[model samples]
Target: MEKKERKRIVLSSNTAFSLYNFRLHLMRTLKEKGYEVITVSPEDGKYSELLKKEFSFFPVKSLDRKGKNPIKDLKLFFEYFLLFRRLKPDIVINFTIKPNIYGSISAGLLGIPSISVITGLGYVFIREIWLTKFVKLLYWLAFRFNRAVVFLNSEDLNTLRNFSKEKSFLIESEGIDIKHFDLTLCKEAKKDEFAFLFVGRLLTDKGICELIKAFESLKKEKPKVKLIIVGSPDEGNPNSVSKGELEKWVKEGLIEWHGFQEDVRPFYCMANCVVLPSYREGIPRVLLEAMAMEKPIITTDAPGCRNVCVDGVNGFLVKPKDVESLYFAMKRMVELGDEKLREFGKAGRRLAEEKYSVEKIVGEYINLIEAVLSKS
Candidate 1:
């Protein structure tokens, strides 16, 4: 009898933080099932250290996350090409815009099967500037060479349908660890003042300004309400909020900014409600975490965000970027009282178990991987 060798899988993303936070479960499962998992991304501060501790981590120095330098992009493409050629992975799975584009192209050039996960359309599509057309063109080229495309929401699939003729699948999200984020884990006593937690990058597209405005208005009527923001400014993103502006809000006692937390479970445990007024997302992980922790939510009725909540069931949905609509939703949540809010949280937990559990999502990925590999 001959010994069988495990297939090698390369997972590339924009940042190591994304790979660790979003795809850790999938990577761990793949390793447990006897596959070599390699992670490729830019070294993202402490997150790179975290990823390095778990699996083989490759730092792509040429990948300028938000830069438009063609020379740097070309270098990144070559870096992926050489890396894939040397490692000779059975397959490559890419996330985020740049990784999807450059990584898929490089993997295709090496005749390795690749899957691009469109985590979210994000800024390029939201702003629709000159770079938007360029990115779309690159996406069309990369996706054409890809074996499959995965979307977190249907809207993103529909939006990019014309870009790729390949088979596309919607996975909802990366999926939350229902057990790890169990409601029972949240043992912290609720504070005297009602606290609303917002977790994500402090970017303009995240509706940070609008959230602040709405909270400012809500605070006048209900002095007991508190807004806690948990995220760091993305310096690479043009839409990122200025530190000065954030400090001004904090100085004014409008928000409690706790930047970049490795563990957000405590914040979730303390929060009365979770809010993410994002303009759009592939699917907000924060919402999933909140749901797993059995916390009520309020989010924009935008693409990815809408998929998480059924209006008036688990939480309230407000119009995207509409300050007044957001304010009203927050006001409604406050008025719902503790009992109704608890009911909402319980409903959210049910939804998380049914739809967004890590077990179910990992099964989907395993199935997809098997099918893709068999055909290849």
Candidate 2:
């Protein structure tokens, strides 16, 4: 009889928060199954202490989530290579932009298996720019030796399929923790306010600007309606709105702005409906969280967004970037009556339990890892 050695898995992204919030369950599940899960990302003073408490956290200097600095990116790529040369992880899973591109290149250089998870085709894919061409070329190069390529939505899968050596897979979300978003958190007394909650980064491409416009319009029609904004302004992103603008919105009493909340349950509870008017998504985590909490949702009919919101079923689907469409959806929500909204909430919760539970998501990831390993 012998004890088999546990495989070491390295999970990487540009930001520690992305790994902390999205991949914890996957890490925990793999760890429980006797895999050593290590997190590699740039150090953050706010989250470094918390990250260190759980697993092996390796801080790399290469990640700049907002801007594209080629020298910094090259340095980050070398950082990954050097770290891999030292740590020698059995497998690597890279997320977000920089890590997926450069991390995969690092893994390929080391002759180690890697998986690239396309979380979202963000600002670059939103427009047909020279940068978009460069990004696609980089993606084509990085995934040369990847074990598997994963996409959160089909649109992105189709967009980048030709780049991957192997067939790409879709694991929309790793699934949400249903219990963490219990329906009991909904605040019934707040119904008179008819609050709408918008979560995620405060990037203009996330439809934050359009959301504000629609919210302003809705407010003129129904003064009691509330728009509660969660998440912080990412100054690093070119699409981010100015702090002065956010301050104006808050001071003028347009939105109840709560910046970058680690715990968003309170916001979900305080809302009658959740909204995300993003240009696109790779399946929105916030909308899934809202659904799990039995909060109705209103989102764009774009890739990742459409995956969660069912038009007129669990929530309404408006066209992306169309302020009037979003305005119409909001107005309709106010007129949907309380009982109908509640029904939407209930349907959303059921969808979360049946389709996007953490258990299901973790299992898929586990299976994907095991399947890849078995082939080797």
Candidate 3:
């Protein structure tokens, strides 16, 4: 009698879209290769259909952004433990904060093989030392048991290395689908008024406030310059910008806020440049998408953002949270006019093709997963 192949895989993450989009590709790809993929996330309407159609969905009560309660966190821990025991997955892949910490812990308890991807070290690690220390300890303990720890940026990989003796691997930003973000489809940008686009959760840590302040200041001198802000407030995130504050910016006519849109390519297409002033990132997907679209960029010189923009080449790099620096960079892009900006955009597209394409990144994930399975 032939022994049945045992290859049950589990993927856990807090962000619905992160699981649905980037990780979904992996799930489908793996399933096609004959592995059963189970997805765990905060059950939401957005993912219900896909879960029903494609994979086994496990609803886990997670701290959704702002609703952080210690009691609730405890509940989540138990929930994770229960799920792990029930699934008895041969391999587990965890992403984001809560999952990476609690999920890894649960997997360890069950003696399950696990892999964790450090997408970004969020607010907890970026703030005061006490909290940072606490979160670092969680990472140290949880990550120690994983088969592989994947980082999106070199700096993050180095940081993880500093904290522990574990060998960590690096991947280009959460892989962008090059075919989906083709530059050939982009309309020629306007020559007179240069458009600067900001996309991401409307969070303070993402530098939304700073970007708004800088845009307001620049508009005084360059009235013809336009600013477009995409993405909705992440109510769960502690650092999310208040709806009232964003409304005030719109009321003041400082910039155009498009709320949330399912498709971002049109916004990217119409813009001359992409800008992100985030305090930190684990390699922002927006920058990768913009570059894939052949758009010039302006972002802070912080670790992850720096990975995409080569100062003065593909785009300008400014100091994070420095309104004046961001404003000056915006002004300089305007001064460079359309031709120079197009050249920069062309360079950016080439860089994306060479370094950050989806094929390249997905290949890395495939290699990592195969290597882990080989050992198992």
In order, how many clashes per candidate? 0, 1, 2
Clashing pairs in 3: 65-236, 66-236
| TM-score of each model, paired residue for residue | 0.97, 0.97, 0.95
Off by over 4 Å in 1: 188-190
Clashes by residue pair, model 2: 283-304
Per-residue error for 152 in candidate 2, Å, reads 0.7
lDDT score for candidate 1 against the true structure: 0.92
Q: What tens-digit string does per-residue lDDT give for candidate 1 at 128-202?
A: 799889888999999988989999999999988887655888788888998889878766574789999999899
Question: Can you write out model 2's per-residue Cα lDDT over 1-376, one digit (the tens) per residue?
Answer: 8988779999998888788888889988888988888899989876766778888999998678876788988998899999988988889999998899999999989988889999999989998999999999999998886889999888999999888735599997868999889978654564678899999889888999999999999999899899999988887778888889999999989999989888999888888899999998888999999999988899999989999988998999999999999999999998999889889999999999999999998898899988887775
- Please identify model 2 stretches exceeding 4 Å from their true place: 1-3
Measured by TM-score, how close is model 3 to the native structure?
0.95
Kindly report which residue stretches of model 3 are placed more than 4 angstroms away from their true locations once superposed. 1-3, 66-68, 162-164, 188-192
User: What CA root-mean-square deviation does each model show from the true structure?
Assistant: 1.3, 1.4, 1.7
Per-residue alpha-carbon lDDT of model 3 for 262-357, expressed as tens digits? 789999987888999999999888998898888999999987889889998899999988999999999898889667887998898888888887
Question: What is the clash count of model 3?
Answer: 2
lDDT of each: 0.92, 0.89, 0.84
